[model samples]
Target: MNQLNYEEISTEFKNYFLNNYRNFIDEQIKEVKNSKFLINVSDYTSETIDEPHRIVTNFLKEKNIKNHRITNLYKTFEFEFDFYLLMLTFDERRKMDIELYEEIWRHNQKL
Candidate 1:
């Protein structure tokens, strides 16, 4: 596609993340801390917090990122979610480095 066409899609995703997903993640983060797991924030609900993983996994997949096994359980959904949130945050203003954050995601996933 041309540059303009690409910008349109990019804008759409930008708005999508800003208007919805970002806030959703913020709430999820709190929920994850208070509770052991995430309650579905996005409409595209699945049993687990796979929504974040699915989106993150898809994005990475598109960029040709993959792994044979989930060598680190901590490296999946929670890491992806925090990373994405940081990305959006950076886009807006920037930052999720959080070892504790990763541990939380890893811990919950094991549950």
Candidate 2:
């Protein structure tokens, strides 16, 4: 993708994630303390495939996220991971913040 296109796509993806997560947080009766989610990309032949689940799984493994839900476009052969982080309490939200750094690290790898 061109630089501009890449930036647009990246921003869209980031916003989608953050918005969904915030909505999840808003749904809770208690405050959120920690939460995390992941988005993975993989290529079989120099072309990135849309495997959001894989991204989520890898993110979960890399960051040690335990209480989150994932939504993904499915493929038959690979594993899928949660796309949303919904922690109903402050403690869980705190854990999420700790794990969120993994998202930054993972995104940085693409740069």
Candidate 3:
């Protein structure tokens, strides 16, 4: 992508979090103060085959946002090293953050 397109994509990602997931992102920001936190893009099928996730992941890294794209087991294992994980899904209009609290709760019970 060109510089202008990159900027647009970056802006969209920022706006999506600020507008739709502000509260959740705020909580995650607070958690970051006490521990390592990771935001995982759990599904990659929505992105193009040309490594779109890398673009977004690099943008987040520039903003000091810790994140990982869960495309395989190794990546998932690396991401799980963080204390918290926020999974994201792409919908028709925009990306949506999926709360993993219930899944985490259930996993904790198993342990």
Candidate 4:
């Protein structure tokens, strides 16, 4: 397998996240709500927000995406959602990231 340069990885990461941002958030919200936890409690509140933030921020760090963008992307959900849903979102995002990386790699090769 060909190794990707830094710029290619960066572009692919940005494209993957920016393109799927809304769907990712929506899926997360759905997952949290579907978990059947009482969302009004303080513990639930902290878990819902903080856990996903940590999971997603860690994912971004692993992917070399800028951490600050997590705040820009994470908004207040009207309904509670599960933190585990972010894991599912991460899986999907990683797949897209791989595709984007390959696409960028192929495009770069043609030049």
Top candidate, metric lDDT: 4
Best first by TM-score, ranked: 1, 4, 2, 3
Off by over 4 Å in 3: 1-47, 68-89, 93-111
Q: Residues 3-64, candidate 3, lDDT per residue (tens digit)?
A: 23334544566555344344543453344344333323332223322233444454466555
Tens digit per residue, CA lDDT, model 4, 1-111: 444354554455445544556454455455544543433334334443454465556556676545232212356433312232354456655554444344434444554
**After superposition, which runs of candidate 4 have C-alpha atoms over 4 Å from their true positions?**
1-19, 22-83
Per-residue lDDT of model 2, residues 1-111, tens digit only: 222233343344454545544444343312212224323322211111223334434444654445333333574333222433211223544444434444445554555
C-alpha TM-score for every candidate: 0.32, 0.25, 0.23, 0.27
Candidate 1 residue lDDT tens string, 1-111: 222233453454455544444555566456566765543333223412444445545544554444222224565443333364334534342222233355455656776
TM-score of 1: 0.32
The backbone clash count of each candidate, in order, is 1, 13, 0, 3
* TM accuracy, model 4: 0.27
**In candidate 2, where is summed lDDT lowest over 10 consecutive residues?**
41-50
Query: What lDDT does candidate 3 reach at residue 89?
Result: 26
Clash list (residue pairs), candidate 1: 90-94
Best by TM-score: 1
